[model samples]
Target: MSIASSAFLATIPSPDRGVWEIGPFSLRAYALCIIVGIVVAIWLGERRWQARGGTKGTIIDIAVWAAPMGLIGGRLYHVITDNQLYFGEGRDPVRALYIWEGGLGIWGAIALGAVGAWIACRRRGIPLPAVADAVAPGIVIAQAVGRLGNYFNQELYGGPTDLPWGLEIYRRVSPDNPAVEDPLGGVAINDVPVEVVHPTFLYELLWNLGVALLIIWLDRRLRLGHGRVFALYVAGYTAGRFWIEIMRTDPANEILGQRVNVWVSVLVFLGAVVYFVLARAKGPREEPETLRSPDDPDYPDSGDGGAAGSPSGTAESDTAESGTAASGDGDAGTGDAEAGGPATRPGSASSDVDTGDDGAATENTASTENTASAESAPAAGDPGAGGPPEKPGSST
Candidate 1:
């Protein structure tokens, strides 16, 4: 056999599936890794949420809004970037919404998912930066899982290498495919048509997970806030992506044999660096916005006051001023009518006169007090005298 044959022989993947068939379905490592990654992301996010002084319910609230958005965003990203794959002959772009078939771009997912999370956080009255920080590590871990998905799909591999740790091609991509190879000169393997590339997916997975662990550990020890850890995550993951992009043999339009993602990684890494520098220079401080107490007048007690009833019961309390019961009674039908009656209205003729600290001074009493005075004195027999008043006179 020729040297090319020997090289090709070394690059076959070791089929290592436990081969457990659950009835009619098959569970693969790729699916398992992705699921585990999502679970881990949620766990990490919840922990970070609490650390940032968020309510326990915040995670559930956020997930309710974010999960679907992220998934949809990710699918959309995949469809747009690889439009030909989904829009080609006999293909239904609508089916592109089907995520179970599995095509997601990390960048697209992150970008759109971040928006979803921001809206959710805003709705929950949580600070956006704090939410961003909580999500940072999880995103990295999720990317790690996503890379494993690439491995299962047998795509996104790199150039050939003789290294002991080099990935073997369980499945090879065609050079004719624009996605797997660039339009170029002839290159054959083992005197046969084959393109065995590096397993870039696994490399990315391990690196991202490693970076995530590092960020999490450092966050606990350092107590960095304002998404510093997350910024570091972006920086670190981009750094790894940069390195892997160099080794990637996937069909890509490369400027100087470096893929477009390589340049993107550089730009992203620089951004992350700038962010980290600014964050450190500013000296990490807790965002004042996140520091809200239950008693805070402006603090949102529950769902937007647009709900049927405000949780603070301010509406009910205000109603109490109108003769309604001030207690926690839930009744409103008979109570309102009774409370509105003259019998319940204070200072009314039928009710006890309202007295201040001084004394009761009703409308009539006030008018009488204004008229009476010492100067205008009435004599004892003023009625028979025909004079209204006399100065110090008691005789008639």
Candidate 2:
């Protein structure tokens, strides 16, 4: 192939359509991408939470609240920021509710979605920070996946470019009515070129994936807790979004000659940084045992009768065994005294029995010692015994 032709061929082409009609229903690619992203995030979050000693299905439980609230928050942010699109003289306000058409703000989603998560966490008696830390990487990966929706919708592109990898922007119109332009709900009609532009959405998707990996690596290495991992994720994401947001040619609200999102990115990044630094006082990653609240069904009780397989439970079992052995020794010692024979200590079979004048006293003393040994066995077996009580974990 000729060099010019090869270069042109290498350019990325936009999808001809972002929606499909199946029977009487219209399925939107943007909505499918969002749903897929949510599923992936939940799946990954559950695994990560379990790895961090959280109960299974906790992520799903939290998502029941977070997901819906997040969607609402994202849509609200988009509408309020770009009010001109819906509330202008010729625009229709009802279209603001059409989320499938695309437009969600990460900042607002995180802000309000956190409120929902906080409610679920409180109800479950789990620390919100712990859950946030566990799901940090998953959230970033979900964002990356969601960016595919923007690409299919033929939005969020940057200024025109001649680069070999530049994205080809197609002129789309309604299939049934060619005169009516429907950028988000139309099909490309010709093979002729209009203009190739910088694929900003692709750039963001790649960046988000890189951030997810970075967060995972840093979290594993540092054993981040107290929401430090989440803070790191926010900082990392905002850093990338700041630059990517600047590259987009899409119409958006601006503040002080710069896009409002750029300002939001700067503010959010600083907030994340501050939180990450302050969280150091919380010490290292929490012990799995300490993460659960006493009210949690899965919590290990350390009372007189502890939960099965717990340290206190093990100690109690060991104590019972020790007491049984002591009782057997006591019976043997009594039998020897009654038969006018020398009494031997337990586990001292080879040694000569006590036949001295103090024989009765020795048997009594040995019996007392055996009782003491039984009492001390539990303490020896349980490492946490007599230590300070464990404090219950709390959330912000």
Candidate 3:
């Protein structure tokens, strides 16, 4: 191993626990880290949501729904995994609900939190998959900080190895057995020896940090489909956890002498691959048309589907003008010569058609109008003798 790695492994310094002790109640580093992570994630998500042309209040609206669900999911995961410790032997199972004591599962948090977020997005009409992509990197980074909390507790370490990087474990007398001292100075149990194990928490912290960086880099460089980056995160973390679980003495189940987490890693990795492939086949999700700036002359305003400069308004105006002129000409043509004589006609006393012949023409037009009125009758108040309502909405 390199010098830095050797030093990190040989003597990993236990991080200091920054606590605020107010009488009996004590605030801890773990809680603070989680809160900071959540705040930062929400801020970032909000900024991205606005940048993407989403509604003004979408982020805050969604967070109101998603936050509580995430907390519940995280606690539920811990309870399910370590039920034996919480529920058995006269233990108050209600204490399991006390999340301040630090019991949360990342898997459950992500899964159920996603459900909550999805619901929120649906309510707001925001695209759920796109929001997932925006939040993925932030979630991984928060997880990295959470791991440091584990470090302060001096928990979640791995197996022993003389690689000059092994964390020292100072042995202590157990409450039940006060007559044993381990070589590595671990807490003794019934006069038995137990050495200090590896710090898996630190390993996970560093791993998650690296993964977070990788995700940010990929997102910036490539236009990945929605939810793909989050899938990769799941697969990546699961793979790392699988390896670390092998080196640790945790009571997580095993399959074929290997930790059950290993199989989970494999399955998650495969799932990521499958999800990406299917998503590509289905094509990209349709995005809504983004409106230009309000100040732009081309921007749509009240009572219009498009900008004033657009062709729709102009076309409608032109059609109205033409229709009005056509209707007026038709009306004039049906009148007698005395009202408005036609300038051209054979056998006329004046250059215009004779009033008698014009009257006869008017009578014929009135008869024809009554016959065709069945098909194109005007609305309520009968004004002109039968023609389509002088082309309604036409400008005079």
lDDT of 2 by residue, 1-396 (tens): 665445569799899889998888989999998999999989999998888887888899999999999999999999999999999799999999999999998888888999999999998878899999887888888899899999889999999898888998888999889999989999988644478899999999999999999989998888999999999999999999999999999999999999999999999999999999999999988767655555556676533333433423355443333222223223433333333433343345333333333544443244665446333322211222233222122110
- Winner by lDDT between candidate 3 and candidate 2: 2
Determine which window of 10 residues in candidate 2 has minimal summed lDDT.
387-396
Those runs of model 2 whose alpha carbons end farther than 4 Å from true positions after fitting are 1-7, 293-297, 302-304, 307-396
The reply for model 1, stretches above 4 Å from the true place, is 1-32, 88-95, 171-197, 253-257, 280-283, 287-396
How many residue pairs clash (N, CA or C atoms closer than 3 angstroms) in each of the candidate models, in the order given? 4, 0, 9
lDDT of 3 by residue, 238-274 (tens): 7787787677776665679876556766877788778
Clashing pairs in 2: none
Give the root-mean-square deviation of each candidate in angstroms.
Answer: 15.9, 8.4, 12.0
Candidate closest to the true structure, highest lDDT: 2
Which candidate gets the maximum TM-score versus the true structure? 2
lDDT of 2 at 218: 92
- What clash count does candidate 3 reach? 9
The global C-alpha lDDT for each of the candidates, from Candidate 1 onward, is 0.59, 0.78, 0.58
